[model samples]
Target: MDFFLMVISGAFSFYWVFLFTTHTYLLLILSQLTYTDQIIPFELSTHPKHCLSVGTRSRQVRVPRVLAIEGPGEANARAERTWRGRVPSERQVNARSLPQRDSLHRYEFTHPQMGTVFRLVMYAESETQAQAAATQAFAAVDSLNASMSDYLPDSELSRLCNQSGNGQSVEVSEDLWQILKLSDRFSRQSGGAFDATVGPLTRLWRRARNLKEMPDSARIEEARQMVGFQNISFKKGQKIELKKTGMRLDLGGIAQGYAADRCLKILRQNGIRRALADAGGDIALGDAPPGETGWTIEIPASQSKEVTSSHLLTSLRLANCGITTSGATFRYLEAGGKRYSHIVDPRTGWGMTHRVLVTVQAPDATTADAWATAISVLGESGWKKLKRKHRRLKAWLTETPITAH
Candidate 1:
């Protein structure tokens, strides 16, 4: 499980909320503060280190230690009024309570979806509005989960998988279509590094996780045959076709990031600008709190050794974007004295055996999520090759284990 430690503006208690994603879990940090006109108290989550070890976990790609955002001069009315969130890096989020009130209350609400907890911390004037916005946002998540989850047998994604190799294209919901497009784009950009079609291998790997042994080499090869971005073709009008009979589309890596983004959108639509949506550990932030310039994200500084890793907390303050970290720290498999991350490399049907954390920041969580997975596979140098192409994104990496103090 991923550990999230929080220390807010005033007196705050450390709380650990567990969210299960894939075979991994996330420890969430939440704090309660008085909802007042004064600058809204920012709820902070302490990351184990300044760098995040990202892997196929987010099924993601790019940025460095610090990811920049749209500056005040670069932002417009809507953009200025909007804010961004962060991942497992030094990105910060500053916020205010609320201007005149009348929005989602300064409260946190959560629900389980996509194999993790979807959390929303927002502000509003009336409890009624807060409840209403939460209800709508959670409802959207539930609906989206039904559309994307591979675990659900009758989910839209499952239905499409069932149609694999039928030589027929299936029309998807708008939401699913959007995610598919992203999956395709990243898959191409990362050179098959971040593929949603890694479902076959993931299924086999899941068994490996439970059985405590690596899947048979032959089985891995068999599953790998069905895993490739080329196997799934996206047609116009939201039609998706799986050319392979046993292809499975695994969106585990990036779905939550997209969900986090949606959560922020819903919150904004409900008149809540100062908000943050933590989908599992993937973060989606909103406009600065009531008075602050941006949200502050503190990631502990890290020093990696051959066998262990240690960290000191480091903080960065910024606004308006998405962030996610993928690593094998909490979720991985140990077989034959080897540690395997839960993130399955779409290229090779094997979980990464290294100890690397990848934290990616981008304009949205979807990009951050997918790219984190890609970067985990690509390494820092690989990202640096294409870093100039994605100027708005930043990534950070740290390898080894976290030595507890």
Candidate 2:
């Protein structure tokens, strides 16, 4: 089976932080990472639209129109042609040997964004070209963070959050519009298992985790009342209306995925096909590395073993898709004699007390990232419910969320 839930035997935290600059980036640090020993075919599309959005609603919005970098005109220019990278034929591939003439070199560069180190790994023939492309890609990621980050009070998302119950339709930029549209689709598919308008609830839970105390029931109920996808509505002309006055929107679940998608787009535009962009841990992969079957990923293996120098006991290989892991193994709160996962449930204002982890491989990071969170909240049933509609999607979990296929 392509999708299986492999229970992790240990606990690990994703604690990573470093100051960054658009100019200076991370050099390859081989000791910090490792690959999953096994390899599997990622047989998937490599087209470069860089868009993870699928199945357009006849009357709905499309991500194809703009990049939202420099108003509508710049977005139109970037959207000029759906860019894509082409994979080499089988004869041109040698899993055992590196490329011959062009001599593909593996390079790693990283910049800090969205609270984690965003790493970029790729094979390129020219270092100059690769550097320029990486620079542009990181820039794109920063631009997205500026637009979507709720932490930045002046960010577009923050400004939009202030309008939660203004009862006025606000026209958002292309980037914001596209992600919201995608969020709406996911919200509908998961039966409210995922909601972007859980800002108020998220705040309460964040404070709870910070204080190592349970939030008051009265406060949770009040916040829960403001959390619902139904409170927000999309309108024509790329506008959105927040039906409730005190509502807030949060894209924490999907921002990394969306950022990964955008970076891949920038990479592809620069003719860099064999690429991988990791936003925190949410990764978007391109064509397999030259002469390689797929990228190797180190998957967590045991719950009984204590996490030390290496927590990953097994590895898996994949290509041409996005993959991410979301779980209670790392972030959580312990107060009042019970552990609470950092992944808060929108339906309830409390952090999930269950110890579970979900990993999803999808067509793009945006899809993988969002679904991972939804599945964690929805548990095993979420997989069974949405698998039929998302046949191409594959998932693995640290808990028995899905029986082995």
Candidate 3:
């Protein structure tokens, strides 16, 4: 949502390179060019954090805390000179050479219900341009949140929820309508594995979680009766309606990804070539600069100190792609001495029990988000199904369970 660009000096022996300064304590080195006798040779970094940002509308709505830059030694020196306006001492040069900053132009905001932060980074042509872009990005995010959030009484989602049991057709904003249609398409493709018509089920579970007690089997079955994609109908140029009373719709599963996709479009339309947008766990990457393979992404590993071996993602890059992760790491309830995650299978009316996490890569955020949820529910079988149906979709699953001695 926010943009930034660094014009570092071409790498040369003893050459001075300048990196831009930001408010966040991170630097993003877009590229490093080695200038030997004025001949420029470039190398790409295999790090996702190094690549441009990507994601949907919600990402642009939030601000980030860190931004890092990468460059050769000469470029770093030049960056220091540009920001500090002086030749750097050895210590300053060494410290600045690595991606460290005291501040950045990016901004961050927290979501009340989602319990996570959203970030937007920008590289504008000038200070004025940067501010304008940031302002627009923030406004866009507010508009999106107002439209999609269920917590807001007037939000499109909230209005729909209120009319759930009335069998009344609701007119949704164009943006929200598109997301629902996409969810329908994905649900069919995944054999009802990705349904947005699980509002009743999700709400029932939320209440059960708050009470710290499992819902009665009959109650769950009653809620399940209202949870089916087939229950909601939509037509082009028309309002969407629930076929049966008590049927509801919730877009939590795919809304964040849709927001990411929308934000990416806005950034690209504004002539941003490289950026990253993250809405919760959904991330989208803009184009890698010329000669760059892709953005390098870090898949957090079992230990906080270590991530999956970098070698595992040696060639992984998200050039114009979307990445989303779904896991039961949080938001669960305990019953009968067993833990149940917040994510539920629409068809089964049960919370996901296996597979601790699932990360998916796809052409778009919506697909990535829905597939991540569906596959996590499907477990190994879903993985196989996805591999057979769509080769372009790549996935990873992690599981951890308690063992009794």
Candidate 4:
């Protein structure tokens, strides 16, 4: 659930399609051209069966009827000539119409592994080629998800978690190794603000929220014992080991961003230079659309005091970069009048209660995603410290106004 959705091009363009969770919904704005920035809160059915397909609908293309040719070589030559230039009016007698040459072909589909709808809008000569490229990109995303997801017991990450204990080591896939390395680096860089070893605390908070009861302080402290980046070790040849027995890895924070980057890479491999990969709102951009500097991303600000809902705080036109937002505006638990965000502070083993939204922009999606989660937990003081160290990192923060009873 997001308080605000990221607007790609064309108002509610390619990225607007999302699969809602049972407890969460989305705020979708209709065409900005027509509505003047009005938002509609639409609750989607949580049933796995329901999926929304968005983006430009394809127009029917009428292929030109070709006459019989004598030989294969002659037919090939004639086909090449036909594609290069216009055929005579007599040859065009049966030609109907072709898709607009300059039009962009967008293919939207739900990722099988992630269970989230992703849009791949590409500039291609034909719909067939666009669909092919989009399919390849989704396949890339699925491969990454299959390896990184902790939800699946047999996933590579889970396999590593199960093998790690009592100073034991286990060799992992290259993908897992890369993500683990990143998690370790960010954990150290953020002063424990970002940690993949926070899985135990995450599970505890998740269970507590599910039962609508806050976890006891004693239990949270106990879980903290099993969590620490220093407790985990990574070696060459993609080997990883958790020094503690109960340590686990949760890539929820940065895995999607990595996957988005991979999807963009795959699209480029298929000759799609201009594309956008919105992996559940963790966006990675390729070259911008034709004639534009970059893709416009709408970052939602807090709802105005006069308004009842959220709107775009600002818009960023970005090219060849990644952007991610972390906030408690959605998917938070309210217990005893305190709002706890889903993000947990690894150091304290507790969910963050501060109502702050943090958006981070980075050279890549993985970095952006991890930093966004880390900065959200760090709050203003911690973020200032981090910014002092990293001058190039760009961020935006919006805090909810605290009200008195």
Q: Mark the regions of model 3 whose C-alpha exceeds 4 Å error after superposition.
A: 1-115, 165-167, 289-292, 300-315, 400-405
lDDT of each: 0.71, 0.70, 0.62, 0.69
Q: Model 1 segments beyond 4 Å from truth?
A: 1-105, 305-310, 399-405
- Give each model a TM-score: 0.72, 0.72, 0.69, 0.71
Residue 215 lDDT, candidate 4, scale 0-100: 92
In model 2, the worst 10-residue window by lDDT is 32-41
| Candidate 2 to native Cα RMSD, angstroms | 23.2
- Kindly provide the TM-score of model 1 when superposed on the true structure, using C-alpha atoms: 0.72
Error of 2 at 219 (Å): 0.3
lDDT of 4 by residue, 1-405 (tens): 243544434345533443343223323222221222111121233221111111212223343322222232123223323433434333322222221122443344445456555655555556777778778877777777778887889888888788767577888888888888898899989999999999989989988889889899999999999999998887776788788888888888888888888888888888777776766667778886543466766555664423222544565677888777777766678988899989999999989998887878898888998998999999988898779787767888875211100
Candidate 1 weakest ten by summed lDDT: 56-65
**Tens digit of per-residue lDDT, candidate 2, span 1-405:** 323322221111212223333223332232111111111112233222221111110122232221112221112122222123222322322333322223455566889889887877776767988999999999988898999988899999888878877778889999999999999889888888788998898888888878878888899899999988887788999998888878888999999999988888888888888888887778888887543456766556555424342444655567778888787766788887888887888987778877777888899999999999898888886678778888888777674221100
- Between the candidate structures 3 and 4, which one is better when assessed by lDDT? 4
- Relative to the true structure, candidate 3 has a C-alpha RMSD (angstroms) of 15.8
Candidates 1 and 3, the one with greater lDDT: 1
**Candidate rank order under lDDT:** 1, 2, 4, 3
Q: Considering summed lDDT, which 10 consecutive residues are worst modelled in model 4?
A: 47-56
Candidate 3's residue-wise lDDT over 26-81, tens digit each?
33322221111111222343222343222222212221222123331113323323
